[model samples]
Structures are given as structure tokens and as C-alpha cells.
Target: MHEKHKSHQVSGAHKWLKRSVAHKMFDRVPVVPDNFTIGETNDFLKTHIHEFETINYIYITDDTKKLKGILSVKDLFRKNPDVPVLLQAHQDLVVIYPETEQREAASLALRHNIKAVPVVDHEGKFLGAVTGDQILEILNREFREDVLRKAGIRRSHMMMDNILEIPLWTGIVHRLPWLLVGLGGGIVAAGLIARFEEILATNLILAAFIPLIVYIADAVGTQLEAFVIRDFSISRKLNFGKYFLKQFILVGTIGLILGGLIATVTNVLYPDSRIAFIIGIAVLGAVLSSLLTGLLIPFLFRNLRLDPANASGPIATILQDILSILIYFAIASRLLS
Candidate 1:
């Protein structure tokens, strides 16, 4: 009866832990009581050190188990053994609450450059610490999630321990959604170009520049999307206004240089100042619009609780292609008329 009761309690704890947050991952390492002097700490370590797997920093706590400060093993060894442990302890505590998400707890450790983060209750009582091993696990899980999400795969697929063991149909189902969306987007882009038939037919030269405009716009948007997705994965708090301003400055500069080069080349090859002017202005407009579209699309998806990387790639590319065609034709029609 006693063994059964103990097993039941363990099972109950496990169930409870599953519903909890960062507290569930807490590690119960031995903590040094704040009142212990350096000499006493040394004696305690000599006797009780076997209880711990590894000791990087000694967590100093008060009698009631309230965290006081921390002392590194390096600092402890360098100090006089007769001195109080608190004297050598660093008071700047970096702690996380039990309710914090595991990812957030790991991110905190990373941001602060610490091996582990201490878990505390609302009242500041120390519960346990999140070890470096746990942090590593969380990082690996997050990395896998980002990769799979970017590939347009469902997060539930992470449960499949072996990738090669997954059924062929399951893989196709996961990949087919994005491909279908891209197909629809391609149809829409084709229709958009068809609407500009008169402009393309009137000036065959404009048709030649269409590929150049679309390619440059897609390239610039892809670059911005990759940067934004990576940054958002690590830290969600991005200053959109400032980021947009910076991107605008960057895109504007590049557009001018690229537009000038294209205009110069077009004038030399075609010798039509009107055509050269229209191409240059259209290129500048298409690039600026594409850059803004790339930045905003990811942010919109992120706001909608969608994975920015998954949606940004295909959608941004399609949108850039369509917008570049529209901008290029609109400018040519206006200038050449």
C-alpha cells in the first residue's frame, strides 16, 4: 500500500507539472544558506559536494529560502575562507518567475549571458534554478520549430522522432498548402500582366524591362524578409517605425544607384531619352514599393499569429512581381504618352 501511494503521488505530480510553465523545468540543486561564512561553505562543499552533478555558482539564500545573492566558484576560491560568504557574494540577482514561459526563461539566460536562471515565487522565495542543460533543450526545440515553420510544416510534426519514418502522404499534405497558394498567386500575376497588354504592345522596349524590374524587386524583398524573420524569432519587440525608416533610407539609396545605372545603359543602347527616363523612374518606384511590401507583409502575418517566415516568402515574391509590373507599366504609360 505504501509503495502504491508513493507511485500515485509521483504520477499526480507529473500531470500537474505538464500544465505548469517554467516551474516544471526547475532543477533542485543544493543552495548555500546566506549565513554560512566562507570557511563553513568550504567545509560544506567538502562534505556535501557529491550531492550535485556540477557546481558553477553557489546560490546564497536566507533562512526562509529567499534568494539573497550569488557567488561564483572562482570568486569563492579566491576569497579568504574566514570571511562571510555574503561579503564576496554579488548582489545583482537575475531571476525569472515560475509563470514565465520556458522559451522566455531560456531567452533571459541568453540575453543576460548566464548559464542558468533562478526561479522565484511572487514573494521572492527561491524555488529552483533552470540549468544550462534545460536551456540547451529549449534552444534546440525553438530552432527546430523555426526551421519547420519556415518550411511551411505544421508544429505537430515535431512529435515524429524520425523524419525518414514519416509517411509519404503526411509529407505531401504538409508541403502542398504553400505550393497551392503560390499557384494561385501566379495566376493572379498573369492576369495582372494581361490587363497591361496595350502598354506592352505599344512599346516593345517596355516588355524587355519587365523581367529586370520583377527580378530586382523579388531579390530585395527576399533579403529583408530573411533578416526580419531571424530577428523576430529571437526577440519579438522590434521598433517598426525606426526599422521602416532605416529600410526606407537603405532602399532609397539603392534604388537611386540602380536606377541611374539602368538609365545610363538604356540611353546608350536605345538612345531614347524618354524611354531611359521612364525606365529609371519605374525601377526606383518598383524597388521602393517592393521593399516596403516585404517589411510590412511579415509584420502583418506575425500580428495575425502566423509564422512570418512561412507566409512572407511566397506571398512577398508574388506581391512584388505583381506590384513591379503595375508600377513599371504605370510609369511608362505616363511618361511615354
Candidate 2:
């Protein structure tokens, strides 16, 4: 009788609250009162264990249903059954409110190294437990959602299992919006490339290296975007400037190494031409440009109250492509022409 699964089906208006810990919680979790002797509790579970969703941890409450402490099932078995359940329970508890967001609940569960997070009401009354199974589901859903958002797939409803089943128009509506942005960016890139026609004509070899520049820049930017999205998801409140600085130093060092290799390779291939030195500097500039674009775009998106994921794949990659072109030709114009 104590395992009364509360069915607070918050429909329509507050349907979004389905993401809260309350919605995922199992109210049929085994809960005992403060005064139950271990022997009595053992006896009760022996007959009624099938009623509860999980016996991972048994919650204890006072007469008024205020949560007091919790006892692990292992401790329950270790203690003398004649002792009061409260005496065997750990009084120092980690509790979260029913209204806590799913991410926060996951965070709390992780921080405390607990498999289940107990939910309480305003007055600290024991409500229910969001068990390990539910927590796993929450984490899996959030990870997939983050991946889709970062890939600029705007359709949040489509699941991996049914990816092929989504109608053609629905698929395009979600995916094409971001690709259209990329298309506009490509037009701007074409215009930028055309603007440097004089440099390209003077040093035809520079045109040959265009794909190399764009590919390297896009690669660097995609790597940085991975780091940004990871930090944004895990630790939003932590200072981003610190993270970006470490990334800057790391990227700058690698850019120098890669630049040296590009110079060495170019000099080996075209020993007499100033084009070798020119391409090296251009590649270095492209790397740094990519790093800045990757870092700033996500930060800007977050500040604008948008999902940081929207700043990564299409937008960052397109900007890097354009910057790589401008950087490559600007260097060629100065040194090769």
C-alpha cells in the first residue's frame, strides 16, 4: 500500500515538463518509515518486493512522509534485523527536487556517484526515485540530441531507428535550412575567390593549392568545434576564456609545426619560387583563422541565447573555407606577385 505510484500526468499546457526528473521518476520505489525495525522491513519486502520498481536503495521517511535518510540494500542485509531501520540508514543524503531539470539531475547523480536520484517535494517529503535505468535513458537521449543539433539537423523528432522512415518533405525541412545557409556561404566564397583573380593569374600555382588550404582549415575548425560543444554541454557555467586559452596555445603550437612542414614540402617541390614561402605563411594563417572562427562562433551563438550546437558544423566550416581562400590569396598577392 505504501508504494502508491503518483500519476501526476501533467498534460498539454505543461507537457514540456516531461523532461523533468518528476516525469521520469518511479513513485513505486520501496520506501519505509523511520520506526520500522530491520526485521519488520525484511519481512515486509519478502512478501511485497514485487510491488516496487527498484530495491537499489530504500528511502526512509517520517510519519508525515518527510524524507529522513536512505539505506542501501547491502546494508540492509548486513545489519541485525532486530535494529531500527533508521540506525542502519545513512543520514547524510543527496536529494533533488521533482522540478529539477533532467541535465541537472544527471549531473547530481554523477557528482554523488549514485545510481539513483531521489526526488522530494517543497517540504522535503519523499516523492520518488529516478532510477539507474531512467538515468541511462536520459543520458542517451541527451547525447543523441546534442549530436543531431551539432550536425545542424533541426529535426529533433527523428530517431536513429526510424531515420529511413521519415517522409521526404519532413527530412528536407529540417536539414535544408542549415544547408541553405551553407549555400549562401559558398556563394560568398566564390565571390572572394574571384576577387583574387589577379593574384591567381600572376601565380597559377597558387590556384593549384586552393583545395589544400580549404581542406586543412576545415579540418582544424571541425576539431575545435568538437571541443567547444563538449565543454558547452558539460560545464556551461565554468569560465570559457580559460578553456579557449588552452586551446589557443595548443592550436598555435600545432599550426607552427604544420606550417613548417608545409614550407619544407613546398621548398622541396618548388625550390626556386617565392611561392613556397608564400604558401607556408598562407597555411599558417588559415590554421589560426579556423581556430578563431571555431571558438568565437559558438560563444557568439550561446550569448545570443541560441544552442551552441548551431554554431559548429555548417556555419563554422563554411566560414573557415572562406577565410582559408582569403588568407591563401592575400599571402600570394604579397609574396608571389
Q: Pick the candidate with the highest lDDT.
A: 2
Candidate 2 lDDT tens digits, 152-217? 676464367465888888777777877888899999999998998887777677788889889987
Alpha-carbon TM-score of each model against the true structure? 0.79, 0.81
What C-alpha lDDT does candidate 2 achieve relative to the native structure? 0.80
Model 1 lDDT per residue over 3-112, tens place: 11212011223333342335334443547788789988877766766565346677888877788988877778888998999879988999877666677677788888
Pairs that clash in candidate 2: none
Q: How close to the true structure is residue 327 of candidate 1, measured as C-alpha lDDT?
A: 89
Segments of candidate 2 deviating more than 4 angstroms: 1-3, 6-18, 34-41, 62-68, 80-95, 107-113, 121-125, 156-167, 272-276
Per-candidate clash tally: 0, 0
